[model samples]
Target: MSILNSWWRALVALIFPPHCPVCDLPLGDEKGPICSPCLASAPLTSDWALRNDTPCDRLSVKGCEVRVVAMLKFHKAPQWRHLIHQFKYHSRWRLAREVGRLYGGKMAGSLFLSDVDWVIPMPLHPLRRMWRGYNQSEELARGIAEQTGLKVETKSVVRVHYTRSQVWRTREERFKNVQDAFRVAHPERLAGCHLLLVDDVLTTGSTMRTCIQAIVDAVPDCRISVAVLADAGGGS
Candidate 1:
Protein backbone atom coordinates (compact mmCIF):
# COMPACT_ATOMS: atom_id res chain seq x y z
CA MET A 1 0.00 0.00 0.00
CA SER A 2 2.99 2.32 0.08
CA ILE A 3 3.26 4.90 -2.72
CA LEU A 4 6.42 3.37 -4.21
CA ASN A 5 5.02 -0.15 -3.92
CA SER A 6 1.72 0.93 -5.50
CA TRP A 7 3.58 2.57 -8.38
CA TRP A 8 5.68 -0.57 -8.88
CA ARG A 9 2.58 -2.75 -8.93
CA ALA A 10 0.97 -0.48 -11.52
CA LEU A 11 4.05 -0.72 -13.69
CA VAL A 12 4.05 -4.51 -13.41
CA ALA A 13 0.36 -4.71 -14.25
CA LEU A 14 0.80 -2.52 -17.30
CA ILE A 15 3.60 -4.79 -18.42
CA PHE A 16 1.67 -7.98 -17.72
CA PRO A 17 -2.08 -7.76 -17.38
CA PRO A 18 -4.18 -10.64 -16.14
CA HIS A 19 -6.25 -12.75 -18.52
CA CYS A 20 -8.76 -15.52 -18.12
CA PRO A 21 -7.23 -19.01 -18.41
CA VAL A 22 -10.34 -20.60 -19.96
CA CYS A 23 -11.73 -18.14 -22.57
CA ASP A 24 -8.71 -15.82 -22.79
CA LEU A 25 -10.61 -12.72 -21.77
CA PRO A 26 -8.77 -9.82 -20.13
CA LEU A 27 -9.33 -9.60 -16.38
CA GLY A 28 -10.59 -6.57 -14.49
CA ASP A 29 -10.35 -5.10 -10.95
CA GLU A 30 -6.80 -6.35 -10.36
CA LYS A 31 -8.53 -9.63 -9.72
CA GLY A 32 -5.57 -11.61 -11.13
CA PRO A 33 -6.32 -14.36 -13.66
CA ILE A 34 -9.85 -15.55 -14.60
CA CYS A 35 -12.95 -13.50 -15.41
CA SER A 36 -16.15 -13.46 -13.38
CA PRO A 37 -18.30 -15.52 -15.73
CA CYS A 38 -15.77 -18.32 -16.14
CA LEU A 39 -15.16 -18.36 -12.41
CA ALA A 40 -18.87 -18.93 -11.84
CA SER A 41 -19.50 -21.40 -14.68
CA ALA A 42 -16.27 -23.28 -15.38
CA PRO A 43 -17.06 -27.05 -15.03
CA LEU A 44 -16.04 -27.58 -11.39
CA THR A 45 -16.17 -31.24 -10.24
CA SER A 46 -16.88 -30.96 -6.55
CA ASP A 47 -19.16 -33.99 -6.62
CA TRP A 48 -16.65 -36.24 -4.89
CA ALA A 49 -16.72 -33.94 -1.90
CA LEU A 50 -20.34 -34.80 -1.35
CA ARG A 51 -20.06 -38.49 -2.13
CA ASN A 52 -19.19 -41.04 0.53
CA ASP A 53 -17.30 -43.42 -1.75
CA THR A 54 -14.54 -42.32 -4.11
CA PRO A 55 -12.10 -43.75 -6.62
CA CYS A 56 -9.36 -43.96 -4.00
CA ASP A 57 -11.28 -46.69 -2.23
CA ARG A 58 -10.74 -48.97 -5.20
CA LEU A 59 -6.97 -48.89 -4.66
CA SER A 60 -7.27 -50.03 -1.06
CA VAL A 61 -4.05 -51.32 0.47
CA LYS A 62 -3.74 -52.80 3.92
CA GLY A 63 -2.80 -50.47 6.81
CA CYS A 64 -3.91 -47.42 4.80
CA GLU A 65 -7.09 -45.67 3.66
CA VAL A 66 -7.34 -43.21 0.76
CA ARG A 67 -9.97 -40.71 -0.35
CA VAL A 68 -10.31 -38.65 -3.56
CA VAL A 69 -11.68 -35.19 -4.32
CA ALA A 70 -11.60 -33.07 -7.43
CA MET A 71 -12.40 -29.49 -8.40
CA LEU A 72 -13.72 -29.84 -11.98
CA LYS A 73 -15.18 -32.50 -14.26
CA PHE A 74 -12.78 -32.75 -17.21
CA HIS A 75 -15.00 -34.63 -19.65
CA LYS A 76 -18.42 -33.20 -18.93
CA ALA A 77 -20.38 -31.14 -21.47
CA PRO A 78 -18.83 -27.79 -20.67
CA GLN A 79 -15.38 -29.39 -21.05
CA TRP A 80 -12.49 -28.72 -18.69
CA ARG A 81 -10.04 -30.65 -20.87
CA HIS A 82 -9.17 -27.55 -22.89
CA LEU A 83 -7.96 -25.78 -19.77
CA ILE A 84 -5.94 -28.78 -18.71
CA HIS A 85 -4.44 -29.13 -22.17
CA GLN A 86 -3.34 -25.55 -22.07
CA PHE A 87 -1.78 -26.10 -18.69
CA LYS A 88 -0.01 -29.36 -19.54
CA TYR A 89 1.17 -29.14 -23.16
CA HIS A 90 1.11 -25.45 -24.02
CA SER A 91 3.41 -24.30 -21.15
CA ARG A 92 0.53 -22.40 -19.63
CA TRP A 93 2.30 -22.52 -16.30
CA ARG A 94 0.36 -19.59 -14.95
CA LEU A 95 -2.79 -21.68 -15.05
CA ALA A 96 -1.48 -24.12 -12.45
CA ARG A 97 -1.10 -21.57 -9.65
CA GLU A 98 -4.30 -19.73 -10.51
CA VAL A 99 -6.31 -22.93 -10.66
CA GLY A 100 -4.69 -24.13 -7.46
CA ARG A 101 -5.60 -20.90 -5.71
CA LEU A 102 -9.17 -21.31 -6.92
CA TYR A 103 -9.33 -24.83 -5.55
CA GLY A 104 -7.83 -23.78 -2.23
CA GLY A 105 -10.28 -20.90 -1.96
CA LYS A 106 -13.20 -23.22 -2.66
CA MET A 107 -12.03 -25.66 -0.02
CA ALA A 108 -11.04 -23.02 2.53
CA GLY A 109 -14.19 -23.35 4.53
CA SER A 110 -14.65 -27.07 4.04
CA LEU A 111 -14.63 -29.09 7.23
CA PHE A 112 -12.83 -31.95 5.51
CA LEU A 113 -9.80 -30.01 4.22
CA SER A 114 -9.23 -27.64 7.12
CA ASP A 115 -7.21 -30.22 9.00
CA VAL A 116 -4.84 -31.37 6.27
CA ASP A 117 -1.24 -31.41 7.55
CA TRP A 118 0.60 -31.39 4.24
CA VAL A 119 0.13 -30.98 0.50
CA ILE A 120 2.07 -33.53 -1.54
CA PRO A 121 2.20 -33.24 -5.32
CA MET A 122 2.46 -36.12 -7.73
CA PRO A 123 5.98 -36.35 -9.12
CA LEU A 124 7.15 -36.47 -12.71
CA HIS A 125 10.07 -38.56 -13.83
CA PRO A 126 13.38 -36.70 -13.61
CA LEU A 127 13.74 -36.63 -17.38
CA ARG A 128 10.29 -35.22 -17.90
CA ARG A 129 10.82 -32.62 -15.21
CA MET A 130 14.06 -31.55 -16.84
CA TRP A 131 12.45 -31.33 -20.29
CA ARG A 132 9.51 -29.29 -19.02
CA GLY A 133 11.58 -27.00 -16.73
CA TYR A 134 8.93 -27.46 -14.06
CA ASN A 135 6.39 -29.92 -12.73
CA GLN A 136 2.80 -28.71 -13.05
CA SER A 137 1.74 -30.73 -10.03
CA GLU A 138 4.41 -29.07 -7.90
CA GLU A 139 3.30 -25.64 -9.01
CA LEU A 140 -0.30 -26.44 -8.10
CA ALA A 141 0.73 -27.86 -4.74
CA ARG A 142 2.72 -24.72 -3.89
CA GLY A 143 -0.28 -22.52 -4.59
CA ILE A 144 -2.61 -24.67 -2.55
CA ALA A 145 -0.11 -24.73 0.27
CA GLU A 146 0.16 -20.94 0.26
CA GLN A 147 -3.60 -20.42 0.50
CA THR A 148 -4.44 -23.16 2.99
CA GLY A 149 -1.55 -22.62 5.39
CA LEU A 150 -0.52 -26.22 4.80
CA LYS A 151 3.08 -27.25 4.28
CA VAL A 152 3.97 -28.48 0.79
CA GLU A 153 6.37 -31.43 0.92
CA THR A 154 7.61 -31.31 -2.65
CA LYS A 155 10.30 -33.97 -2.23
CA SER A 156 8.56 -36.31 0.13
CA VAL A 157 7.63 -38.56 -2.78
CA VAL A 158 9.40 -39.26 -6.05
CA ARG A 159 9.01 -40.94 -9.42
CA VAL A 160 11.47 -43.77 -9.35
CA HIS A 161 11.03 -44.69 -13.00
CA TYR A 162 9.52 -43.42 -16.20
CA THR A 163 6.55 -45.21 -17.70
CA ARG A 164 4.64 -44.97 -20.97
CA SER A 165 2.05 -42.22 -21.20
CA GLN A 166 -1.29 -43.40 -19.84
CA VAL A 167 -3.28 -41.47 -22.43
CA TRP A 168 -3.91 -44.32 -24.90
CA ARG A 169 -3.88 -47.22 -22.47
CA THR A 170 -6.87 -49.19 -21.22
CA ARG A 171 -7.75 -48.87 -17.54
CA GLU A 172 -6.00 -52.08 -16.63
CA GLU A 173 -2.94 -51.14 -18.65
CA ARG A 174 -2.88 -47.71 -17.08
CA PHE A 175 -2.99 -49.17 -13.59
CA LYS A 176 -0.24 -51.62 -14.34
CA ASN A 177 1.91 -49.01 -16.08
CA VAL A 178 2.14 -46.73 -13.08
CA GLN A 179 2.51 -49.55 -10.59
CA ASP A 180 5.91 -49.43 -8.83
CA ALA A 181 6.69 -46.21 -10.66
CA PHE A 182 6.68 -44.10 -7.52
CA ARG A 183 8.49 -44.45 -4.20
CA VAL A 184 8.47 -42.22 -1.16
CA ALA A 185 11.86 -40.57 -0.79
CA HIS A 186 11.21 -39.24 2.66
CA PRO A 187 8.83 -41.62 4.29
CA GLU A 188 9.75 -40.25 7.68
CA ARG A 189 8.42 -36.83 6.64
CA LEU A 190 4.95 -38.29 6.15
CA ALA A 191 4.88 -40.56 9.16
CA GLY A 192 1.55 -40.28 10.94
CA CYS A 193 0.74 -37.04 9.06
CA HIS A 194 -2.45 -36.30 7.13
CA LEU A 195 -1.48 -35.69 3.49
CA LEU A 196 -3.42 -34.15 0.65
CA LEU A 197 -2.14 -35.78 -2.53
CA VAL A 198 -2.41 -33.38 -5.43
CA ASP A 199 -2.43 -33.67 -9.19
CA ASP A 200 -3.50 -31.49 -12.10
CA VAL A 201 -6.08 -34.00 -13.30
CA LEU A 202 -7.49 -37.37 -12.31
CA THR A 203 -8.24 -39.56 -15.31
CA THR A 204 -8.87 -43.20 -14.33
CA GLY A 205 -7.37 -42.53 -10.87
CA SER A 206 -4.66 -45.03 -11.78
CA THR A 207 -1.71 -42.70 -11.36
CA MET A 208 -2.86 -41.31 -8.03
CA ARG A 209 -3.72 -44.75 -6.80
CA THR A 210 -0.28 -46.01 -7.63
CA CYS A 211 1.37 -43.07 -5.89
CA ILE A 212 -0.88 -43.45 -2.85
CA GLN A 213 -0.12 -47.13 -2.58
CA ALA A 214 3.61 -46.53 -2.50
CA ILE A 215 3.37 -43.74 0.08
CA VAL A 216 1.01 -45.63 2.36
CA ASP A 217 3.20 -48.70 2.15
CA ALA A 218 6.22 -46.58 3.07
CA VAL A 219 4.52 -44.64 5.82
CA PRO A 220 1.89 -47.11 6.94
CA ASP A 221 0.16 -44.83 9.43
CA CYS A 222 -0.32 -41.67 7.35
CA ARG A 223 -3.82 -40.63 6.32
CA ILE A 224 -4.09 -39.84 2.62
CA SER A 225 -6.55 -37.65 0.71
CA VAL A 226 -6.54 -36.92 -3.01
CA ALA A 227 -7.31 -33.60 -4.72
CA VAL A 228 -7.15 -32.84 -8.38
CA LEU A 229 -8.10 -29.83 -10.45
CA ALA A 230 -10.08 -32.07 -12.83
CA ASP A 231 -11.42 -35.62 -13.01
CA ALA A 232 -12.52 -37.65 -16.04
CA GLY A 233 -14.99 -39.61 -13.84
CA GLY A 234 -14.95 -42.81 -15.91
CA GLY A 235 -14.98 -46.36 -14.52
CA SER A 236 -13.10 -49.30 -15.92
Candidate 2:
Protein backbone atom coordinates (compact mmCIF):
# COMPACT_ATOMS: atom_id res chain seq x y z
CA MET A 1 0.00 0.00 0.00
CA SER A 2 2.86 2.39 0.85
CA ILE A 3 4.59 1.66 -2.47
CA LEU A 4 1.34 2.08 -4.38
CA ASN A 5 0.68 5.40 -2.62
CA SER A 6 4.11 6.74 -3.55
CA TRP A 7 3.65 5.78 -7.18
CA TRP A 8 0.18 7.31 -7.22
CA ARG A 9 1.50 10.55 -5.81
CA ALA A 10 4.30 10.64 -8.34
CA LEU A 11 1.90 10.08 -11.21
CA VAL A 12 -0.41 12.79 -9.93
CA ALA A 13 2.47 15.19 -9.51
CA LEU A 14 3.64 14.55 -13.03
CA ILE A 15 0.19 15.27 -14.42
CA PHE A 16 -0.66 18.30 -12.31
CA PRO A 17 2.48 20.12 -11.33
CA PRO A 18 2.21 22.23 -8.22
CA HIS A 19 3.35 25.80 -8.32
CA CYS A 20 4.40 28.11 -5.53
CA PRO A 21 1.43 30.40 -4.95
CA VAL A 22 3.58 33.42 -4.13
CA CYS A 23 5.89 33.25 -7.13
CA ASP A 24 3.81 31.27 -9.66
CA LEU A 25 6.85 29.07 -10.29
CA PRO A 26 6.55 25.31 -10.52
CA LEU A 27 7.55 23.60 -7.33
CA GLY A 28 10.94 21.89 -7.65
CA ASP A 29 10.18 19.29 -5.00
CA GLU A 30 7.49 17.94 -2.70
CA LYS A 31 8.85 20.16 0.06
CA GLY A 32 6.95 23.10 -1.29
CA PRO A 33 3.57 24.57 -1.67
CA ILE A 34 5.76 27.62 -1.49
CA CYS A 35 9.30 27.68 -2.80
CA SER A 36 12.12 28.29 -0.32
CA PRO A 37 13.17 31.48 -2.10
CA CYS A 38 9.73 33.01 -1.84
CA LEU A 39 9.43 31.95 1.78
CA ALA A 40 12.88 33.37 2.58
CA SER A 41 12.39 36.58 0.64
CA ALA A 42 8.88 37.23 1.93
CA PRO A 43 8.49 40.12 4.37
CA LEU A 44 8.16 38.52 7.79
CA THR A 45 7.31 40.52 10.87
CA SER A 46 8.97 39.92 14.25
CA ASP A 47 5.79 38.70 15.97
CA TRP A 48 7.10 35.16 16.35
CA ALA A 49 10.44 36.26 17.79
CA LEU A 50 9.13 38.83 20.28
CA ARG A 51 6.50 38.42 22.94
CA ASN A 52 5.72 42.12 23.00
CA ASP A 53 4.84 42.95 19.42
CA THR A 54 2.35 44.85 17.25
CA PRO A 55 -0.18 42.03 17.09
CA CYS A 56 -0.17 41.71 20.88
CA ASP A 57 -0.46 45.45 21.37
CA ARG A 58 -3.15 45.93 18.75
CA LEU A 59 -5.33 43.17 20.18
CA SER A 60 -5.32 44.56 23.72
CA VAL A 61 -8.79 45.58 24.82
CA LYS A 62 -9.82 47.42 27.99
CA GLY A 63 -6.35 46.76 29.48
CA CYS A 64 -6.61 43.02 28.78
CA GLU A 65 -3.80 41.90 26.52
CA VAL A 66 -3.75 39.07 23.96
CA ARG A 67 -0.41 37.62 22.95
CA VAL A 68 0.13 36.96 19.20
CA VAL A 69 2.53 35.59 16.60
CA ALA A 70 2.46 35.94 12.80
CA MET A 71 4.47 34.56 9.92
CA LEU A 72 4.34 37.21 7.20
CA LYS A 73 4.52 40.98 6.95
CA PHE A 74 1.59 41.38 4.57
CA HIS A 75 2.31 43.75 1.71
CA LYS A 76 0.47 45.30 -1.24
CA ALA A 77 2.27 43.18 -3.78
CA PRO A 78 -0.11 41.26 -6.02
CA GLN A 79 2.00 38.14 -5.83
CA TRP A 80 2.00 38.23 -2.05
CA ARG A 81 -1.73 38.87 -1.89
CA HIS A 82 -2.28 35.99 -4.28
CA LEU A 83 -0.55 33.64 -1.87
CA ILE A 84 -3.33 34.22 0.62
CA HIS A 85 -6.04 34.55 -1.99
CA GLN A 86 -5.19 31.24 -3.58
CA PHE A 87 -5.67 29.38 -0.36
CA LYS A 88 -8.44 31.47 1.15
CA TYR A 89 -10.66 32.49 -1.77
CA HIS A 90 -9.84 29.70 -4.17
CA SER A 91 -10.53 26.03 -3.36
CA ARG A 92 -6.92 25.32 -2.65
CA TRP A 93 -7.53 23.61 0.67
CA ARG A 94 -4.34 21.57 0.68
CA LEU A 95 -2.33 24.72 0.07
CA ALA A 96 -3.97 26.31 3.07
CA ARG A 97 -2.99 23.42 5.38
CA GLU A 98 0.53 23.29 3.98
CA VAL A 99 0.86 26.99 4.68
CA GLY A 100 -0.40 26.34 8.18
CA ARG A 101 2.00 23.45 8.69
CA LEU A 102 4.95 25.46 7.42
CA TYR A 103 4.06 28.44 9.59
CA GLY A 104 3.31 26.19 12.56
CA GLY A 105 6.75 24.64 12.32
CA LYS A 106 8.25 28.11 12.56
CA MET A 107 6.09 28.92 15.58
CA ALA A 108 7.13 25.63 17.20
CA GLY A 109 10.68 26.97 17.17
CA SER A 110 9.62 30.05 19.12
CA LEU A 111 8.46 30.60 22.70
CA PHE A 112 5.27 32.34 21.56
CA LEU A 113 2.99 29.35 22.01
CA SER A 114 4.76 27.80 25.00
CA ASP A 115 1.78 28.09 27.35
CA VAL A 116 -1.07 27.53 24.94
CA ASP A 117 -3.41 24.62 25.69
CA TRP A 118 -5.68 24.61 22.65
CA VAL A 119 -5.65 25.77 19.03
CA ILE A 120 -8.99 27.34 18.22
CA PRO A 121 -9.76 28.41 14.69
CA MET A 122 -12.10 31.34 14.33
CA PRO A 123 -15.45 29.87 13.27
CA LEU A 124 -17.83 30.80 10.47
CA HIS A 125 -21.59 30.97 10.47
CA PRO A 126 -23.31 27.76 9.39
CA LEU A 127 -24.73 29.48 6.33
CA ARG A 128 -21.31 30.72 5.28
CA ARG A 129 -19.65 27.41 6.04
CA MET A 130 -22.22 25.66 3.90
CA TRP A 131 -21.48 27.99 1.02
CA ARG A 132 -17.71 27.86 1.39
CA GLY A 133 -17.57 24.09 1.98
CA TYR A 134 -14.76 24.50 4.52
CA ASN A 135 -13.56 27.00 7.06
CA GLN A 136 -10.12 28.35 6.17
CA SER A 137 -9.18 29.10 9.77
CA GLU A 138 -10.13 25.61 10.93
CA GLU A 139 -7.99 24.08 8.21
CA LEU A 140 -5.17 26.34 9.35
CA ALA A 141 -5.60 25.35 12.98
CA ARG A 142 -5.43 21.65 12.10
CA GLY A 143 -2.22 22.26 10.17
CA ILE A 144 -0.75 24.18 13.07
CA ALA A 145 -1.74 21.33 15.37
CA GLU A 146 0.24 18.94 13.19
CA GLN A 147 3.45 20.69 14.26
CA THR A 148 2.64 22.19 17.68
CA GLY A 149 1.41 18.98 19.39
CA LEU A 150 -1.63 20.87 20.64
CA LYS A 151 -5.23 19.80 20.04
CA VAL A 152 -7.21 21.71 17.40
CA GLU A 153 -10.46 23.04 18.80
CA THR A 154 -13.43 24.02 16.63
CA LYS A 155 -16.85 23.75 18.30
CA SER A 156 -16.54 25.71 21.54
CA VAL A 157 -16.59 29.08 19.81
CA VAL A 158 -18.92 29.86 16.92
CA ARG A 159 -20.13 32.66 14.72
CA VAL A 160 -23.81 32.91 15.47
CA HIS A 161 -24.55 35.91 13.29
CA TYR A 162 -23.86 36.23 9.63
CA THR A 163 -21.46 38.95 8.41
CA ARG A 164 -20.54 40.61 5.17
CA SER A 165 -17.05 40.40 3.77
CA GLN A 166 -14.59 42.72 5.53
CA VAL A 167 -12.40 43.36 2.50
CA TRP A 168 -13.62 46.80 1.44
CA ARG A 169 -14.87 48.02 4.77
CA THR A 170 -13.36 50.90 6.72
CA ARG A 171 -11.69 50.15 10.06
CA GLU A 172 -14.71 51.37 11.97
CA GLU A 173 -17.01 49.46 9.66
CA ARG A 174 -15.00 46.32 10.16
CA PHE A 175 -15.39 46.60 13.92
CA LYS A 176 -19.10 47.14 13.57
CA ASN A 177 -19.61 44.07 11.41
CA VAL A 178 -18.20 41.70 14.00
CA GLN A 179 -19.77 43.22 17.10
CA ASP A 180 -21.70 40.60 19.12
CA ALA A 181 -21.23 38.24 16.22
CA PHE A 182 -19.74 35.31 18.09
CA ARG A 183 -20.95 33.09 20.93
CA VAL A 184 -19.49 30.38 23.17
CA ALA A 185 -21.52 27.24 22.73
CA HIS A 186 -20.02 25.18 25.56
CA PRO A 187 -18.25 27.39 28.07
CA GLU A 188 -17.25 24.48 30.25
CA ARG A 189 -15.21 22.96 27.46
CA LEU A 190 -13.05 26.06 27.45
CA ALA A 191 -13.14 27.17 31.07
CA GLY A 192 -9.70 27.84 32.54
CA CYS A 193 -8.05 26.80 29.28
CA HIS A 194 -5.19 28.55 27.51
CA LEU A 195 -6.42 29.15 23.96
CA LEU A 196 -4.37 30.08 20.94
CA LEU A 197 -6.70 31.50 18.29
CA VAL A 198 -5.64 30.76 14.74
CA ASP A 199 -6.47 32.70 11.61
CA ASP A 200 -5.15 33.43 8.13
CA VAL A 201 -4.42 37.14 8.46
CA LEU A 202 -4.67 40.04 10.92
CA THR A 203 -5.28 43.46 9.42
CA THR A 204 -7.44 45.64 11.66
CA GLY A 205 -8.01 42.66 14.02
CA SER A 206 -11.67 43.46 14.51
CA THR A 207 -12.66 39.86 13.88
CA MET A 208 -9.96 38.32 16.01
CA ARG A 209 -10.57 40.78 18.86
CA THR A 210 -14.30 40.16 18.87
CA CYS A 211 -13.77 36.40 18.89
CA ILE A 212 -11.33 36.58 21.80
CA GLN A 213 -13.70 38.84 23.70
CA ALA A 214 -16.43 36.24 23.18
CA ILE A 215 -14.27 33.44 24.57
CA VAL A 216 -13.07 35.48 27.54
CA ASP A 217 -16.54 36.74 28.30
CA ALA A 218 -17.96 33.22 28.42
CA VAL A 219 -14.99 31.52 30.04
CA PRO A 220 -13.53 34.30 32.11
CA ASP A 221 -10.58 32.27 33.31
CA CYS A 222 -9.30 31.20 29.89
CA ARG A 223 -6.07 32.86 28.79
CA ILE A 224 -6.08 33.99 25.16
CA SER A 225 -3.35 34.27 22.51
CA VAL A 226 -3.46 34.51 18.70
CA ALA A 227 -1.57 33.15 15.73
CA VAL A 228 -1.82 34.09 12.06
CA LEU A 229 -0.17 33.22 8.81
CA ALA A 230 0.27 36.96 8.16
CA ASP A 231 -0.35 40.28 9.86
CA ALA A 232 -1.47 42.99 7.46
CA GLY A 233 -0.67 45.63 10.11
CA GLY A 234 -3.76 47.51 11.23
CA GLY A 235 -5.51 48.27 14.52
CA SER A 236 -4.43 50.01 17.76
TM-score of each: 0.83, 0.87
Off by over 4 Å in 1: 1-19, 24-31, 47-55, 75-77
Give the per-residue lDDT digits (tens) of candidate 1, residues 23-135. Answer: 76678773656678877787776644574344355545677666777787656534456667777887867778878887887777576676688898899999999888788
* Candidate achieving the largest lDDT: 2
> Per-residue CA lDDT of candidate 2, range 67-108, in tens?
777777666444777887997788888888888887788777
Worst 10 residues of 2 by lDDT: 52-61
Clashing pairs in 1: 45-71, 45-72
TM-score of 2: 0.87
**Candidate 2, which segments miss by more than 4 Å at Cα?**
1-16, 28-30, 53-57, 76-78
